[model samples]
Target: MEPDRDSFTSLEPGGDNAIAVTLGILGDEWNLWILRHAVEGAKRYGDWMREGAISNSVLSARLGALTDKGLFDRVQYAHRPDRYEYVLTRRGADIWTVLLTMWAWEQTWAPPATPPLPRMRHIGCGEFFSPATTCGECGAGVEAHDVVAELGPSGAWPRSVPASITRRRSAGAKQPSQVIPHTMELIGDRWSAAILGALFLGARRFGEFSERTSAPPTMVADRLARFVRLGAIDTEPNPDRPDWVSYRLTPKGVAFFPVVVFMITWGQRWFRAPEGPALIFTHRGTGHEFRPRLACDRCGEELTASAVSIEPVAD
Candidate 1:
């Protein structure tokens, strides 16, 4: 499926919503990497081939999809065979902040199996900096504990983001939980977020996680180790085999529920489907959809961009 006509052209028929559509367009396993490389100056077909290990067919498809999504505009640099280079448009450039947040998260909480590449420097500050998300209304820190539920239209919603509700069966409602800056490293994108999402949905073993996400076994194992280190999950012995191990989300890992739910909310609004959402979250046994909110813990207002601001990093 493609993004709703609002953002990009229809790539396929039937979508759950905008989140599904956008993910369909931009959330492919290799798509974001393509953007990251483009930002760093990789353009030629061969350049992608050499560095990204992408096959021609998949690369071609993703390139077309991204072009349709308005991120990349192609420029014909060659004439004989009409070869072209893909360049970033303003839309493409805009996603960099999302990427930067992910990079900051990886640096802080989820280091790769190999040593990380060179660090990012803020040109203005002339120093390596870790990015943070803060309340626009107040300079106070944004944590899980600092937010509340301001649900529905009385609650302000972004022009784009739709509301998310979880566990329809429960009489109780859910509030947007605490999310510190470092937590961005964990839930901002697919791999890390997908792991948490799958675990929350009840996949426990290594094989189960591998099956649930696009991540390969190596990435899964690496991230599981990182999560263990971060206290998001704990290892439990398999009863059938003493040597076999399974992973479960720690309480801290469980706290990431709102982030995944919000992704669904945001995706649904932007990536609309003809029929309905591709997937929905509900409580086990009761089978109720959950409704979630992003509220301010301080003034208890519905948090919006106009109401939030980033705080200066403490020296």
Candidate 2:
């Protein structure tokens, strides 16, 4: 019998252990907060609470949830008190690249003066770092608009397309969650994109996000929640205001910096004003402008959206 369409299928069926870690972790606000704290070295409960303004109940619940998911380990740090601290497991640390990318993105697009708390650096290079997205082949910069969608060689497609794209093109309906459709769904919405941009710029407060985007407070709240669920943003308690809350990017959220940086760089180059962008990024070490280009790391070839192919890895 044919399997149900909604049932999950592995990219590699029983070949390698490719767990659906993305879908599993991205489900709620607290989980995201736990991750953010873990990234910030908030292993102990007291340290986490001190680092952000999360409520005790919420923090407890999120810690438990993360521990349950195997992203964090609750190890006993105190003997008499029988206290535990949360630490990132290997699976958790693997997502750090994503966080660094997100931080780099915010530094570029959002307001430049007020950066997010706790900046990132490349430990290996010992320099304050901004992540760059070069082409996997060419190492040159590419923009989102420069990429166009086409049918894959395998003839696979996402299950659905946004209404706006469909209206723009007189093509037949396609499956949703296919590559192009999924891409649009991920980044097409202005509010969603704006929220991401703001987060990159260090606007974690509701009012700050709303002010930055000129979006409704309610909309910002909803989007923040959604981002939290997507493991893109973490919701935490406000440090100064006990009843209030704040948000920050998780490691997964930070990893998205490359995507944001690429898109914004593309926008600036293709859509900037005659006077140039309201903001620009510079390489801290070289004192040169950082205009990212996407090229393949191995082949040094520019990868257009159409030029790339996604093959399911063997399990």
Candidate 3:
């Protein structure tokens, strides 16, 4: 169901905070690509061009735009040659978590082979990693059907009922709740998901992101701004050039990488492409692929969307 835009309130009542800002920054494909490259250690424009073949104008614009949004730091590596490099800030590094999650999804659901890519394994145990949803608190596995979606404090709720619901009522169907909230809303857009995929592959510059996703510049800029506001990235001053800047993910942002890994896994399993995954992650210790699963830290149980419920604390 569509969210109630009227009732939804911003996490920051008056304005966007770090989280909102970061979200705005990473929301776009170009910005995301810039982040991706930074993650992969792309510092020079030449490096970005060689990797992605993006237009110079588009790349320049995206870099400048990301700098303005605080996602990138530009530093002059050579004054005489007028060469510069980009780097990620603490904030930018944080977004890796999100990228990891998306990668996991793509690997599982969108496999290049009919039998699917080789199974991911735990680096420590040498056990094949299986997809499981567990509770965040209890560590118990949860299923999609076990949890119910509800409107959160930050979301807009309907001031009035939608015409479709009202019409359904007229036809004798039960009127659903006035509010509905789900985790999917946090990362629902196809573009957003795809952008996260590119980031997982280490595309940190606009050109690289565009090359991977083929997204438009304007849209990429907008999304990158969202990610900035969301606190997913940090802009830093280039050490060599005080006037230039580079972008990176924050710790919080990096934590979201697991979400990307999960997404890739899902995509590979469910949505195969003519070609295989651009890249695959293997367990460094186990010599096996890593398939991430979400589980509750407290109980080690898998967490599913339907398995948990939230209640507001008393004021």
Candidate 4:
């Protein structure tokens, strides 16, 4: 059955939330890698081919989808057998911080061995630094414990991201050449992503998770087990009910909050709704709406793609 186009177009989480819609656009490994390469200066068709071992057909499909999704603007750079280069649109360039945050998370937890992930030099501070997450309003550092999240105007409605819309790796597809980070594993799966979001929202019991995410019991059980295996969450016997269990985020899981914050920031900024945002975060310290900003860990200045340089990582 075809997924509902109208439902998918909206930015709400209830069958039509922005986060799920954005995830449908970016949740695939190849899609993420393509965005990474784009940030690293890949534009022309040949540029991406040389940057990664992606096949022509796959790359073509990805580029087309990204372009259709408003991340890239394809422009003709030549004629005759007309040739074009994909340029990042404003919406596309904004993915820099999201990718940077993911990179930082990988470095700390899933360190790759092939070649070290590139060093980031913040030209603003003239120092090599990791990206830091901070509240844009007050400039104070932000963490899961430092903020409280509440359902926004649209958030109160129960919505389930259509499972069919999310892109998934085929069983026979080539495994991602880059080291798959925990962030990828968690976010790439719709159910897993929704369940983790539920945990952050204080859904400790199984029923709450299932209800909030609108995931089937089997799917929820499978992802919850996977989270435990990844050490992102722990399962504990419920104190009041011996028959049930509670899921709690481990330190590693809580550490993933920055990625979630960035994802929410990017998604909400790009995807709008007539009602309101799906989630509103209030910084515990400032008592102000939490808008996430990526800053240089060394000098505390905001990090921008132009203001920072990434040393290319070897494939």
Candidate 5:
């Protein structure tokens, strides 16, 4: 169904929209890589430089921005040369779940290639495991279908779309060795991320996706096609109209729920609208507001940065 044109709104920067604010921060490829490296113990300026192969000026700018966003604490480590390192703050460390979920998605969906992402071993269980998103209150596993979403007090789409500063950079830049290319393709682009978010929000038709994302129809068509090729989304016959089809998440797409949930949780904590979070999710099974926690599939204990180690993918 085509949504009413007047019903949708665009988000402007610094608005009372948590998703917009969060997207503006983490939507960049470099930023995601930087945060990923930070989680992996890349603290020194040269550390991320070597790991990401990012140029100095861009690295400096990104570091500064991250510091400003309260994600990193810039501490001087040397006196004579004024050397400093970027350390993740509590809020920044919370991004572990986001990166872990992305890793899990890539492990399940990314085409195998050289130098794949390292395997994560849960130290508590002494076994490698993928992250499972679970409810904090009820301890039940969560998936996209298990929740009900409603617009919060400040849930209305904003007045203008937030600018995507990373698209051109990501398009022109070379792929980094320690990067998640598939995840980047899905989320490195703001429009794609918005479309994914829209799908999770119950947008099923072409027009609905376009309206919900505020993206051009042509762009929406292109992304939907790309997702279909990626096996993340599939098309089904629309019973309401035989000529029309609805787009729905395949298991692969549904598996991406953790990534979305983590991002939303991070955004809610770091950014806020006047009314509250832009979107509110409630677990239908628990009948309570859903708070996502990433736990190890092996031990069923909550995963933490200090409790896990990364190792080469076993042959």
Candidate 6:
């Protein structure tokens, strides 16, 4: 079914503008998990339960919320009592790139939790390429050290001081600050990242997450609960199965895209698997890897951290 774009993307203004707009729709942990499943084929409640292992009450709430938001079409698959299956609408499918970016980020910076992640064979070139992002405009490779940021008219920082930034750029430490960002403290653990990445890659069932992440069931359940509480994910009831539920992403949850893409480009620039890059993602038609470039919307010059300045909005 065609999804109403307005339903999912209607933005609200508040603190930090875009981030705030994204946060209103975003929930913590399990929301993205559910959407990941929907993309992969977990249409019925039982399919979700068996896969995500979410509680009954929580699942019901999430399903209703997602349907209301128009991310999923609650299509009636059965007639006896009008059984329904939660299917992904166009807006929902758009989240796949966010998830895909995470998967690539995980493979590159998140460390080797398991032996070679599922290989991504580029259909055009028939070689493994890690998923990557390029500038939507100029198509230059984006890197963390190269970009500068400042508030747009709609954005305001809470403080009026110069932003001080510090980072350790090493990928070798088990708990290296470079590979793991503060944002990932909750979901950064390999297991949670793997689970989220799996969902984005279409592994919905709990068993599938386990297999994909090579984690035990207990670990999967633990991370799922953590994600749900953090408001990064949500759940819903699956109608066709009657006994199961579904999981889906909130808009706020989908807002994690920029972070994922940033990390992916960072990984691409810095860390590489000992054997080599595990996978590569290329354009379907062009077969060229994503080369992200960042330039000013107006002047169109390449962005550089040294050349940029940021100041808090005066209160």
**Backbone Cα, N, C clashes tallied per candidate:** 34, 43, 146, 6, 3, 44
User: What is the alpha-carbon lDDT for the whole of candidate 5?
Assistant: 0.78
Candidate with more favorable, higher TM-score: 5 or 6: 5
Q: Write the per-residue lDDT of candidate 3 for residues 1-315, one digit (tens) a residue.
A: 221222221222423222223334443445555565566677788867774546677678777766554446677889776888876644444454444344344444333432222233333333444444443333344442233222223212111011111011236432211111111222435344445545544556665556655567776666566667656656677676677554566554554555544443433332222233323545433444445456433444454423323122232
Q: State the C-alpha lDDT per candidate.
A: 0.53, 0.48, 0.45, 0.78, 0.78, 0.48
TM-scores, each model vs. reference: 0.51, 0.42, 0.40, 0.90, 0.89, 0.47
Per-candidate RMSD, Å: 12.8, 19.0, 23.3, 3.9, 6.6, 21.1
lDDT of 2 by residue, 117-164 (tens): 245433333344444465433344543323322222211111111112
lDDT of 2 at 43: 85
Evaluate model 4: give its lDDT: 0.78
What stretches of model 4 exceed 4 Å from their correct place? 1-15, 111-115, 156-168, 313-315
Model 3 score (lDDT): 0.45
Let me know the TM-score candidate 5 reaches against the reference structure: 0.89
Tell me how far the alpha carbon of residue 289 in candidate 2 is from the true structure, in angstroms, after superposition.
0.7
TM-score for candidate 6, residues paired by index: 0.47
Q: Which tens-of-lDDT digit does each residue in 1-315 have in candidate 1?
A: 433333633323431234434444443336656776777677878877775456787678778877776678788998988999998766565554445454444445444423243355444434445544344344433443344322232111122121221111235432112123335345434466557656765788988888766577987888788788888789999988889898987766655544444545545444445544544543333334444444443344444322333222332
Rank list by TM-score: 4, 5, 1, 6, 2, 3
Off by over 4 Å in 6: 1-3, 6-8, 12-16, 24-27, 111-119, 157-315
Which residue pairs in model 5 clash with each other? Answer: 10-158, 10-160, 11-160
TM-score of 4: 0.90
The lDDT, on a scale of 0 to 1, for candidate 6 is 0.48
lDDT tens digits, residue span 179-198, model 4:
45577668777787788788
Query: Which runs of model 5 end up more than 4 angstroms from their true locations?
Result: 1-16, 159-161, 168-172
How many Å off is the CA of 138 in candidate 6? 1.9
lDDT of residue 126 for candidate 3 = 34
lDDT of 6 by residue, 111-197 (tens): 553323333434334344444434544465444323333223433322111121122225752231112232453344455555664
